[model samples]
Target: MLSPSPNSSKKAFSRVALVGKFHADGIEDHLKDLATLVSGLGCEVFIEAETATHLGLSGYPTKTAQDFAGSIDLVVVLGGDGTMLGIARQLAGSNVPLVGINMGRLGYMTDIPFQSVKDTLPKIIAGDFEADTRTLLDAVVLRDGKEINRALALNDVVVNRSGISGMVELAVQVNGSFMYNQRSDGLIVSTPTGSTAYALSAGGPILHPHVAGILLVPIAPHSLSNRPIVLPKHSVTVIEVVNGLEVIVNFDMQSQTNLQSGDKIEVRQSDKTIALLHPSNHSDYKTLREKLHWNEYPSTF
Candidate 1:
């Protein structure tokens, strides 16, 4: 068990919104339990509109994502990292911090486990947590020099080929300077906070959250020499589709749009950021070791 900070006895967030993964089973019970506990702490609780609707929950106040922005002090998210990502992006620029209770696999950003929620949530609500501010990426899709679509991502922006399509030919540029032409399955532009996600699996290096950098990872390039590279946080990366069939650009894999052969994606760090609250005992290395099984030895001798 982790010990709380010395300030645990002091109240931190007086108003909190509970956001949960609507698709998960038995989520109502969890929300109810959380509401009971939170209200007992003398704090006002609001349920995210959709989650409340899905569970048909009554008695608790409900607020939409937009409504939560300036009204709430903190957001308590329950689910996997995907759920956290969605809410974080929705609530970006609000300056309201978020804490996650993990109910999914990998549980990277969703640090608190369900078994530990009771212990952790109270401590966090009482000002016993560490705060981390993470960067977001703003991406715009252009066709014929006209902006066709745009989105924001807390994890990564991926441009990839659709099913049965051949390798995508992409022309890359950094801050208006030509970089390379690559034939590959796809490309990933990840922020430091997302270094351990798709970028890591694509052979990109893990950048600590404090690093002010962006990562460009090639997804199985035709030429093995095309490796991942780190770019300055201010560098604007433009990826033009030289050729491909049914190419698609995804924003954190939550939203996507089809890309034309001449389409270009412009990606850059956004002015908005999301804050994550963790227990005082949280450690990035500890999370990596536990989540990636680094501390476990191989069973086969």
Candidate 2:
């Protein structure tokens, strides 16, 4: 029911990668709807090859997220923000602009509403879009100076106690300066983009995405006096297990790795970044108000 932007050009690009998690209820139908819309726009729609079998889609060449990312100019992700994260990880270093259509809850990453795609898609194809270049964090676990596990997150990285009881002592440092040694449930080191996520849930404040800073929030400190602190972008937060107890480290609420006592964990902004495609002039406050219902006052009309 919406029209393309006035300046849309038909010769922009002819190929697209439609990525989504079709297993969720009602998602398969949404994928079909998206494909139809893309087709109507005159672009050749290629479902991520591997996703074909799961979605039971036919007549289109199926490809893995990796393979499809290599051949497409744009990637349209369906479902929620988490689904987009899964797909975007595959497109890292590929420089393919990603558009996320929110079909899930708390879709901070996938901020676009499903119904708005009618107008949104056209604007994107015409290159009438904005890009948010988000820095990714890379965490590498070392076992006696040898690389064990390495991963990236658009959100935060957490290191916490394994069992429900008892507190773990964490030695915190920033750029080689010692901060504190505290006993708490865990610790969260989040980027500005992740400030509103789990970090907020653990009593951290919301930071505008443009802020070149990181948040170091302690989760339920045993002393009750410890509070969250913001550090500069050029800083590095190094965590060490001072008490020689085993603990778990979670990356972006997805994957995890366990670091034994005496192991050192270093976290820093990655040289790599994820580029998100926005529709231009989009304000961070606007999204916060809309998504969080900031104006939903109790007694307002």
Candidate 3:
């Protein structure tokens, strides 16, 4: 496991922020219960402005992500990994630790279940929890030697065919060295944190969250020889559209942009890291076993 940050002991979560997915079933009740439970612990609680509006609950202070990051000591995300990913990107460099409550399917990152919130929140608020830091990816799109779009992703960055029905050609380069030129459906450049996400579906290896590496997985490559490769965390990967085919660049499945031929996409490790707080008993291997239904059957006589 990667060493915890030196400032982990300095975290005093007196001001907490609540972020949730809008229009999700049972979210309002969960939010209400979470707010009451948090306030009972003698901590000031704030809600994300949009979530607050959606729930139609007034009187509690609400703040945008940018404003909330500056004032809140901790952020409590009440949804699945997708919601956490959105907030993670927003609060990347804020240094505000995040605790996730699992309210959606496949809560790999959001380990805390709704039933355990009552028992878990107090321990976390008291600084009696485990802190795991995860790396993020910074992706930039360049066209004609000029920067066009940039975004951050907690999971993987994907470059795939957009509107066309056929495969596209993409030239790959790493650290100024040519890697490969292939015709495939797309490519996934994922961080260790994303190994179990979309990358896994593409046959990429599952890298532990603490691992300092990036995964390059080809999406349905036409060539049988094409395979996934793990690169150094600091390596800069460049992908250029070679066939003038229209392609889409997706960031953690959250944001996307269209790309034309000759456009270059660069992905690298970001300096910012996400501080994820988990219950003391939380285990990554256990999560994988349960979520992925691995080794569920015992040996039979």
Q: What TM-score against the true fold does each predicted structure earn?
A: 0.94, 0.89, 0.93
Error of 1 at 191 (Å): 0.7
Q: Candidate 3, residues 160-253: lDDT per residue as tens digits?
A: 9877668989999999999999999999999988999999999999999989999999999999799999999899999999974668999999
Minimum summed lDDT over a 10-residue window in model 1 is located at 1-10
Q: Please name the candidate that would achieve the greatest TM-score relative to the true structure.
A: 1
- lDDT, candidate 1, equals 0.90
lDDT for position 39 in model 1: 74
lDDT of 2: 0.79
Which of 1 and 2 is the better model by TM-score?
A: 1
Count of backbone collisions within predicted model 1: 0
Q: Compare the candidates by lDDT and give the number of the best one.
A: 1
Give the local distance difference test score of model 3.
Answer: 0.88
Better-scoring candidate (lDDT), 1 or 2: 1
Candidate 1 per-residue lDDT, tens place, 1-301, comes to: 2233343446788998999998888788888888877777778999999888987999999999898877999999988899999999999999999998987465779998877877888888988899999999999999999999989999999999989989999999999999999999999999998889999999999999989999999999999999999999999999999999999999998999999898999999999999999999998887898988886545683
- List ranges where model 2 is wrong by over 4 Å: 1-13, 68-70, 104-106, 244-246, 296-301
